[model samples]
Target: MTRRTRRTRPSPTALPGRTVPVAGSIAAQSPHHCRTSPFSSRLSYDSESMRCRKGRTPRTLILPLAPTGPMIRRMPPLLTIHFLPTTVESARLAGTVAVMIDVLRASTTVTHALAAGCDSIRPCRDVVEARQLAARPPACPDNLGPLLAGERGGTRIDGFDLGNSPSHFTTTAVGGRTIIFTTTNGTSALEHCRPADMVLVAAFCNIRAVADTLVQRNQPVHLVCAGTDGEITAEDCLCAGAIGLELQDHGGFDTHSHDATRIAISRYQQLAHDSDQLLAELRDSHGGRNLQKLGFDDDIAFACRHDTIDLVPAFDTHSSTIRTLS
Candidate 1:
């Protein structure tokens, strides 16, 4: 029988200052503390100490695993507004961000108004409210202290302060004034989405900027197309789809395409071979058809340009007005 000798193991507590011998080293059994390593003096590793030497991982570092996607510090909440095929009803706007899109004129007009430094816009559904508000002195506390503006059948309503035209919303006329606005299609759409957290009036005139604004805000946005008199209009849908595409690209927004929306997006993507082509399409659209008939063909052409302005007006519910969002 062969006699076997027992090997003594090093005592963990016997090691001073939590130091232990590394296997297969001349200094393994030595008590002297050698800070330098054979590999690199600057990269010494004390196995027993469970720490790296000088100029390695810092002690103060608190690194966590990297996140996979974009790290949004403050993501905005979701917003949606139902697009009704018929004329807008006040009930549809309950508790939603109403995006009133009248690509032909109203939305374009409002965009012009804001760009011209109009203080705010109060959208009214009832012409009576607009008339009453307009009749009252601009100093009346009950009113928005706005200039009443609207149109009926593409003509300015009789006895209103101003007409619905992008050109009409100049600094000379609208600067620093609240506009109490109503329109055949635009204000009706605005009234429909009054329930929304933010009501935005958009058009091709400010499409790209509006899209960027929506993404920066990081909210679920809905584009409401103010089609002509209870009928879907191609121009409004095209503008809305342009907005939807921009939102999807920038903010990863998902838009469930309805027939109207889908058609608009498809048509614009196909017909609008380029920016100039897009302008031509806008001029040829149903709303544009009427505009051309009304001899405002130039206005349609001008309003079709993308990213014209960086202004994004957000609806203020308390004041019942639209103000430029910072």
Candidate 2:
């Protein structure tokens, strides 16, 4: 394959000692202390003087003089991870693509619901809110009546049509129905992320799809973990780290990436090499332990599997619905 070359003019105020394309070869020019003849790529410079590296005639090459003013730098795009919803400031989410993870159940369930042909999902903050939303008339003429789905204390709430299990969202049950969902952490995290430019729901099952979507969008990202009962959960962080690792193959992490992201990345690396270990870690995590006590081992296994689902669902704050991204 032939590489295409593009020409760009060197800025006078470029960073000190940074490499730039000059003539036909690469040149390392300092904007402040050193100067070089533009025509010769063989010239070298030190703090004291400029000299030719080889025996060649010294020639004058006119280049723009470096500027001696204050330099304004642009902020690099960031892939930040918040261990809990409370850790993120709403203002920072204004222009970022937010990824909300509740890997043990909520996110995984939502992804399955959409894939199973649910019309849409409206996330409610509480059981009462979910019931109220379900009782309300459909906003659109063609929209189906909403079904109530949620969990409290890791068990299905009384009088609800379904629970927060990925298996509960099968095509035979959730198909052709809208779900008014409420959960302890996931739904509330979605509400907290309403200010973001875009909100995406992610779990281990659809991690690759979420990472691919993030790479295509190429925007600043905030990975918000819906921690278990106001405490950080290892499962959510692991999912975020898995997505972040995939993103590394695309743009990679920058200086602006958060410390929490680093922690999550490190946690993920521990089990990244073994699928069995990854499953064990999830089963031992805080959220995982709670589900285990409730005998939801199947749900935990479903959520721990990576790249099982290919669809990436995004939350629309205006419509109050979660739907597959176009």
Candidate 3:
């Protein structure tokens, strides 16, 4: 993982076409944030020498990089996304870290489960498989029965311990339990990204944490949106766009697909303010409507929040479980 240190100096004019990263902690401003403060500029990650220079103070401090590291001179990986996956084979995402997004409920629910102190979450491929896992859970430190959770066509499945709603994943019910989870959208995306070098489950609930984790990893990534059914969902796209915005703030440019990142960022920037409008748009989205129809109004509100939960849930390749990283 890349480590970042901060330094401050008078802001200098950034070179043309150069976009610097917001160093250390994330910048507490909108994606379209404008700064008038002379000391507002932060440090940028330099891929060339190994030192933080103290010369001309620019809007962003350009820290020197290790003179010789795993330096690849290609365009940095683009903030890319596959709107939905009908099949499990994703070539473009073959070896890149894949973050599965299912904002409305699945991702949000699992994140809450972890934050609420669930030991771990084992994502099953299907309802039947989840039931089987729940029936015979693998050996663990705590031999408690795993909680069964899932949904089908936006409604709770029969006999499952919990539906794909964040509200139900509270501490009292899920704390200290192992969640054997299967969702209509998020789980399928996780399986499809099996070819990924790494898999992360993300949502608005923990989007900032996810972005920060990705920045630290300093590797290329592919975001797989668990679309509603087989079509694109606005909420997922918006979340993906938000990821792009955060990555951009971390010097993730010079390597990414403009076509993909552009639209997502544009979409998010257009609606970032005015919570009521964003909620209305989400309510009218296909996935949102389906969730609303099933009376998941509270869940919708829950998912819209950003940075509320500070956990980054990553799929453990060997154990096949989603574990939170401290």
Candidate 4:
């Protein structure tokens, strides 16, 4: 005689159990199948379990509503982008990823210094602290003597080794050097974000590369504009928008941009057809106008070029210096 095994079927009203029929098979036997199962109670699916009512897929019922009437997309929890006219407004960057940009010179110079093989760029808000750091000896084996570098009013600080110009960061001067750098606005912006999770210095010269690094790190990023004397500067806003566009391209996290940010992005897109025109816009920018008056017009021109370098400098708080992120 041959023996046979009989499968058991759970009652329709029974709670989920070991002997429960396969989801589809049980559903096929019930007239109220659409109203049955765990999903019926909550109207949603369990993400972890990967199980849902027989005919429902998680996304089918949870589709997002179409945005209407000047809607701004909601940002995710991890990433946020802020737009401010000055570093003073960036005081809230303490626990976030603060990215400081002074596209006309300071940030570009710092990037150039690191690219030229400087061990580190020590950004100081106080000129006095900058002088003190420059007076101190290097703390590492590869250390070169501290090279004092900074500027006040677009001119080299009296008695300093170098000024805050990208042109001054040539290999002959910055190679194997430890630069104690200070600036009227850029360094102050960096200092404001000193307590951040990570502080980065950016400019048009290294915007794309910096954006790539930020995407890899997947941390919350705040772009701080070192505007001219606490006022809004169009150049910095444009640079911020460039970085914001790249962040959107990377596609992992959401972006929260202010009115300034939206305006910058609009301006950038408008000028995309003619870069020279965009560069010309900088000549009239608040910061650019001040630099020109102070005889640093060349610096503004140099900073407008996009993707001039692949270096991304990150502030190492422990050493109080900006170093190339590996």
Candidate achieving the largest TM-score:
3
lDDT by residue for model 1 (32-96), tens: 22242122333344444322233422112122344777544443334342344353455555554
What residue runs in model 4 are displaced by over 4 Å at the alpha carbon?
1-91, 140-144, 256-258
Model 1: per-residue Cα lDDT at residue 153: 81
lDDT of 4 by residue, 1-326 (tens): 11112122112222121122222121223323223321244323222221222232222112245577654544432444444434235556666778888877788899877766677787888778888876776674455578889888878999999988786676567777788888888887777777788888898767767776776666677788888677778888878877876665455445544555556656665653455666778889998898899887777766766654556789888888898876
| Highest-lDDT candidate | 2
In order of appearance, the predictions have TM-scores of 0.68, 0.75, 0.76, 0.72
lDDT of 2: 0.72
Model 2 lDDT tens row, 1-326: 12112111112222111211222111112222112222123223322211112222322223334477665443435889999999988777999899999987999899878766677888988887777777784663346567889999988899998898886676668777788888889999998899999999998767767876786676789999999999999999988888877665444335235788878877776676655667788889999999999998777766765544457789999888998786
lDDT of 3 at 127: 88
RMSD of each: 25.5, 18.8, 11.0, 22.1
Sort by lDDT, best first: what order? 2, 3, 4, 1
Off by over 4 Å in 2: 1-76, 139-144, 252-256
lDDT of 3 by residue, 31-128 (tens): 21112111113222222321112222222323446578864454555566666765235766766788998898788888878766688899987888
lDDT of 3: 0.67
State each model's CA lDDT, in order. 0.61, 0.72, 0.67, 0.66
Better of 1 and 4 by lDDT: 4
